[model samples]
Target chain A: MDSLTSPVKSAHPEGTAYGTVLDADVALRFSTLDAEYEAIRERAALLDLSGERIIEITGDAASAFAQRVLARDVEYLTAERCMTSLVLAEDGTAVDQVVVWGRETGLLLESSVGGGTRLLEHLKANADAGVEITDRTAEFALFGLEGPYAWGVVGRLIDGELAALPFESVVDTQWDGVDIVFARTGVTGEYGYKVLVPAESAEQLWTKAMEQAVPAGQEAVELAMLEVRQPVMRHEAGEGVDVLEMGAGWLVDITKEEFIGRDAVMAAFEAAAERRTVGFSGGDTVPAAGTPVTVDGEQIGEVVHAVHSIGLGSALGLLRLPPDLAAAGLKLTVGDTEVTTLTSPYVTPKSWSTPII
Target chain B: MTLEDLRAAAALRQQTCAQIKKMIVSRLDLPIEPAWITDDQPLFGRGLELDSLDVLELYVAIEAEFGVALYDSDMSVFGSVSRLADHVNPALAPSA
Candidate 1:
């Protein structure tokens, strides 16, 4: 699979920095990380989510096949609803965290940014007799609006009523006479909305949206996602890291009778977890993955991933530690800098207090 | 800090988180086991999808179970089970 470049790449600012994440070429920064982060946190930011592949599953047995593959129960998911689910391998490791959107015909799975190819292969390998898996990436372009005041953008650019739709709600709506699939969803802990538009209209819509909201690139989006503890699979998932160790078990529904990885998941749940992922923040310098986390000169854990958190004003990342030592409020050392094991939502999201009205 | 001492400190926070999880599963009458709920998963909106009525139930349950009144606290206290533990037992809260 070739790396995906955004459909609206030409519309991006000239100085925008670009980088590769997995199988996609993404805009790392539209402006400065500081400006983009501020827009996502304080106001509204537009996102060209073309990095995420939109694959549709259709045919007579699509529902059953989706149930067999997805870690969540989506057997009765209607066209008006959407949900986030982890697509797991048979060994209980994550393939990707995807947004399962309910379409009238069948269903669409939105792969995590730069995580499409792997998810597509997994879906094909498990294809049922009557299921039809189609890659719709070239047919449509996905755009997102997020932040405390993103609702205002929805009212001016689309519909006011959509601004307050229940989270994960899906609607077939229109923009300037162009049909699109609109959803009330977001990764950053803010008011978020996404529109799936025809590829030809993507640039026009992107230009208009830029007029109302600052265009945030992948770097800033991932940072806000980290602050809220949302799983960024590329940074977090690695060899031998099971869902239990990832602490992303919430994305799976173990109660369901069957799924591709149910047996392994149950085994993981039944067996005691050796290592668990937990959030941590401290140190001016961001530590690299595999950096030893020590206490009193004794190695206890290792950093899974870390970055300079604009919200924490320090290095913010996760640590894979012994289950007993994974709880919050522990004073530990990562390299030369002392760090503290912290609770989730390392930073309080302003959207929590700011109502759509 | 020694591993033994760290274990002891972690045990305290884990116990609080466990208690809160039990209270939530019991109060919400959820279909899954209390142990199934991870310490870091969100309790409302997206993860657990608990509605406003459920929030009211949890608010009362917390006051009764932990003797902590979170009614005046921001919604972020419910960000995750570990987060709620920090609020109910301030000692477990990591300093900003």
Candidate 2:
């Protein structure tokens, strides 16, 4: 099958450039990266995230099947509610971190770009009778609205009470009279919402959302991820680190009687984690992943990911280090430049006049 | 404020700091003990060295636990445990 395309691609003008993500061609930028970053930070930015895959599981055994494959409990995810979950290997290592949306018919699983294929295979291998898995990647398109004004922009386009919607909650809402699944989620830490519309209606939804939001591309989204400390699939994927070491232990439900990788995850938890993921700043240079980190001339760890943070105005990096050397204020050398370990979230969202419920 | 009032406020601030420290250690599963986190230690750099995602998780956890709302403008409050306590104490106190 051909890789799916974003409906808004045709709308981008002459300066727009495209890139590949998860086998799909996506708009990398419409203008300068700084402008796109500002749009998401100061005002609002719309992102075409259709490159991410959506898989549907339908059957009487859908819930049970999810319970078996996912690390988190699915019982709380009633219709219109979503939860971030991990698909773990039998050894308890994370295969992917996905957002599971509860639907009345069954469940919709949204994976990071290029992540659905593996997850689909895992489900098929483990599924029992009465469960049916369908790849709906091309059938729907996802658009995200992010920034301080994201809620306001979405509120103006839709007739519902958008502000009252809690984070991670999904609702069936209308945009320009087209039915769309609106979820209070985004890669950026700002107040954001994601609109999931049928492929045919995606262009219409995007145009309407764009009226109040500027177009942002992958570069801005990635910068936002780093500033907020959100883990990307590529950065988090690897050996030697389990979910606990990745700072996502809350997603695992050890109370579950049985699930894939339960024993391994339990054992990993029992053993002390040798290395942990950390964020660092105060570096003049952005180090690439696998760059060696040294403390007092002794190798302690390596950089997993790093980027020049527009928000923090410094080079920030995600590093994996020995827990003993991971304390704040600990200085380490990355290729001759000294970087100090800092707590994550180089930036925070602006205060809201009304509390987010 | 009067001396008695000052005493009460200081005591309240200390309690709030302790509570926030406990929340951070438990929610983030930090290897260090809560008592080891000094009130003046920076919560981000040169102190706990929490990553950005950890801050996001802590934000959610704090809102759920203390009924306090943190936003981008409030980022400075995270400079230290005492600063966070100073910011969140009013939110946790009984509404006048």
On DockQ, the leading prediction is 1
Worst ten-residue run, lDDT, model 2 chain A? A348-357
- Model 1 clashing residue pairs (backbone): none
Give the per-residue lDDT digits (tens) of candidate 2, residues B1-96. Answer: 332433354456557777998999999998655755645454653246576788899889889888888866455678666557656766322231
Candidate 1 residues lying further than 4 Å off, grouped into runs, are none
- For every model in order, the TM-score on chain A comes to 0.99, 0.94
- lDDT tens digits, residue span A48-156, model 1: 9999999999999999999999999998899999999999999999999999999999999999999999999999999999999999999999999999999999999
Q: What DockQ, on C-alphas, does every prediction get?
A: 0.80, 0.05
Candidate 1 docking classification: high
* lDDT (C-alpha) at residue B10 in model 1: 92
- Report RMSD for candidate 1: 1.1
- State the DockQ, from 0 to 1, for candidate 1: 0.80
Which candidate gets the maximum lDDT versus the true structure?
1
lDDT per model, in order?
Answer: 0.93, 0.74
List runs of model 2 lying over 4 Å from the truth: A351-357, B1-96
